[model samples]
Target chain A: MSELFDPLLAPYDERRRAELVAAYMAVEHAAAPVPEVRFPALREPALRRTVAAMLALSGRTLVRGADRDWTSGYHDDVAAALAADPACVLPVEDRAVLTLVLVHSVAIPRATGTLGEDTWLSPYPAAADELRRRSQLPVGELEAALRRLRTAGLVTQVKAGGDEAGGYVPGPQFHRLTPGARRRLQEELILAAGPDSPLAAAIRARRRSNEEAS
Target chain B: MSDEWAPGILARARARVTGAVSVPAAEPVPPGLAAVPDGPRTWLLPSWPDGATPAVLEQYELAPMPLDRSGQARRVLAAALRCCWANLDDAPWPGVPAPVPAVLDVYAGMTRGDAALAGRWATGELRRLADTGWLVLDEARGVVRTGPRTALWPHEALGPLRDLLRRMPGPSREALGDE
Candidate 1:
């Protein structure tokens, strides 16, 4: 088979290729899911080849996540470059959801007395409840808002043990943040929740141990 | 410079960075900071006394990585990475650690024995990758995410493999254990 041949995408005109690649490059706000194509059309080898060539030439990578659907991300180099100057351009709802996911990943465990990081997984119903409690948005809008977050790669849905519908957690893009950034965000959470916060207590405990050891 | 406790201190520091664990201070001084003759009582990371080389921090950047070609493990991990790649147009979330069991669950269709082996292989691979700065595993969080140094891996190297996977028939592709 030709090196350029991929069996999963349609033949790419230069305009179409540019549009797709440019779309990915412009996503400085958040990660976005790949646009879905009908299986039959995408199954054509010639089309897939054209698509793969476009992606490779443009330095894009095709990936999948908890949603079990294909998505795309810029190559690591491109992503790092874009991250240097990210803009908060996501829609307000998306921004809100992303913020909640970020805060939830770090704060939820402390709030619920779940010490483990895995408890960061917030179920859909729980998220809806939280949103309702905080923003007072109708419960009906919660699913759509969560879906928007998922599409933006800020939230991931994962199986909740034996639960059929699953739950939400910080998605792949959340992990892309620098450690300094994660630390800063956690610090903010602690401040808002007060020094008596569980996370604060955890930090204090570590510091105390260090002092005693010294 | 020749402190016997340097290794232990360094290990603790790395854990603190990668796993978010709170590490206790080393005797007389904490790791990652320069030794001060009359330093203040409070310990702070990223502070260095004048003329100190910050050896522990420097060593982290230059640590030697052991390359192990455990094919099954690589295949399993690569598959997981590919999934995340397909799902987002950015790097997988560094802050949120993915659950290992959930990752394995996606490939549960494999033969039970192969699936079991894949789990073991994945554990070994994750540890190796974590050591090499390709991945971070938060034991307390029970989650895994890409490491800070993930950009160091060759970006275009997986293109051909991804292309081949893309061309596989749907059912056959499904049989590969991708959800």
Candidate 2:
């Protein structure tokens, strides 16, 4: 089939174009970051630029992995702007559930020094029973919300194992967030989970300074 | 950077995160969307590169979006296809709207005993399928139509689906009497 030449993709040959498209599709659609070793095309600087251009067309940004991987997700600024319009944001109940998960799975662990990384992925799964106790939502409503979150890749269920009753953790979709988005999420978690903490104060101070600088 | 294509690309990208965006009937369908045959609006189905799918995640032991009951969901989708898709030769988007009961009947037919129970299970599965865009459920109209995602099924795979659907029973004639 004769393909229309997209100026953005013209730098690459047909095979390269195919590789770029495949890599983009895999990144956007996959629940997790695609390992760079398997998709060598992502390693090429020119091809990576092409992918970024393609992503820009749609208001997305390329998520370069800290580990060897690649993915694409909403550009943080664009997403925040969109979220200002209520329709574009997650519903209030869903946000509540997500915040609970983040607090239990991420913030609490980090505060206790059990978790080392700033990434959303948490080894300390939030126990369902604990969530039930902490949540203001009714059990049925909370369960239903969790189910929706699970389906959307916002949270994943962990199976019970020796010495640990399985619960929930941040899902693969978290890996798709760009670095800016990840930092923003971390800051948001800190503010929500530890509003009075010295760390939250520091974050607020930094944000204020950055805003003044801008 | 081209001014003309920016809005279209933005619309397609937003639709990827959100659901299908509706285009005016008189307006051209955006670049990424494939127009639904004889349907009111176009639906965006991302064109995947050859031999790549969301399943690529499996190679790295990553699970795709969790489907609550995949087996039941697929069975419900097959039943929706059986009901809505009238022509074997054509692609299955914008297929004829089949009454909700009719699709449920076909689903119930797939299992032995307790048709009512099967129908209940099928109803739940139908909602889940509708939620994921595999089928469009029109509750007020009491009908179900094949959704845009069905268009993603590759042409080569349709032949096997055709054979399987052929052997699978259709909605009993008595059930269709009301429609």
Candidate 3:
């Protein structure tokens, strides 16, 4: 079974670094880091628009709701955003997984990463488990995915085995979608997503609704 | 006033605009693309190009307007603007704040301080001046220059700036800078 691991997601670590810098500035500006915030707490949870645009460049757009069914409008908007952007990296599926991981994290951002484990991680423990469960496929599909990411130079293996979150946390520098990285992702997103695909249609419909409401 | 105080004038204009527009603030802050900086202010900020409103403007400086017209004056200006803009055709709209006479063609919609713009330019009537092509908004230079058509020599062909609001859907960006 092909492995599902993605090494390319490591650049997200760089993003975390940049965000930390911004957060530190905001906290300093606010006179404090909102002491209530802790290593286990989410400092900033909203998917910033610019960051969202950046992630879109990675070939995946964050699904803005709790629903599981992906929409075409979402894909279209994500594609459009990426098309306009030159940043981001990772193939389509990897970007999708990365986006989903980040999106779901909004519900609980403190659980994984440099922030360390927190209550935020607990709520979505199921996600990691799902990855693990899927990891058992005979040919190591998950492993294969991770290999592809490594070959693309997006991920680096630090160690084997999954964490308590049941997800493999790659090295610290694999999560960001650098400018040129995104172009590669855009192509993958379109290829895996397919033109006229149901996912694309739904994304388009969602965008239409949003535009109409505005 | 010397254009050297253009810096001060820019600040004054900003304060007036901030007071005029309703900015939608949310968790993810909306993008403020134009980072026009305040003259003496430390922060390097940009004005919302063509998007300035009196409300946003109040943040910078509140210069008392030269006119004494009251609320009713707005209606007069609106009427005049409608007459002048009535004939303009729809064009590309960048969502930028173009002047009424230039592209927006609706003078009444563009307000300056408490008094309707009519008095600011010493134009006897807002509707009258705008319709005759007497208004020119120099947003970049931070000034509104009124021509002589309405006073020195009226343009007989120029009509009131009404019927032009219909063209607002897609106004050309040039109007904002087309002089």
| TM-scores for candidates 1 onward, in order | 0.28, 0.87, 0.20
Global fold similarity of model 3 (TM-score): 0.20
Give the top-scoring candidate (TM-score).
2
- Give per-residue lDDT, candidate 3, residue A183: 41
Off by over 4 Å in 1: A1-87, A102-105, A111-113, A116-127, A139-141, A159-165, A191-214, B1-179
Candidate 3, residues B3-111, lDDT tens digits: the string is 1322323332232222211122322212332222112321212222122222322332322122323454444434333333333332111112334444223332454
Estimate every model's Cα lDDT from 0 to 1: 0.44, 0.76, 0.33
Give the B-chain TM-score of model 3: 0.24
Question: 1 or 3: which has the higher lDDT?
Answer: 1
Model 3, range A1-214, lDDT digits (tens) per residue? 0011112223345555344323222221121112313211122454233333332222333222122211101233333443443333345556444433333432234423533321112223225445445435434555556545433333333333455334333321222233233343443343344557776566567657988998
lDDT of 1 by residue, B1-179 (tens): 12132343343233323322222344444343322221222222222111122132222232211123445555545544543344343434332445655545443433256767766766666665665444566667666665544332334544664564454322234333356
Q: After superposition, which runs of candidate 3 have C-alpha atoms over 4 Å from their true positions?
A: A1-132, A135-138, A151-167, A170-214, B1-179
Arrange candidates by lDDT, highest first: which order? 2, 1, 3
Of candidates 3 and 1, the better by TM-score: 1
Fraction of native Cα contacts reproduced by each candidate: 0.00, 0.33, 0.00
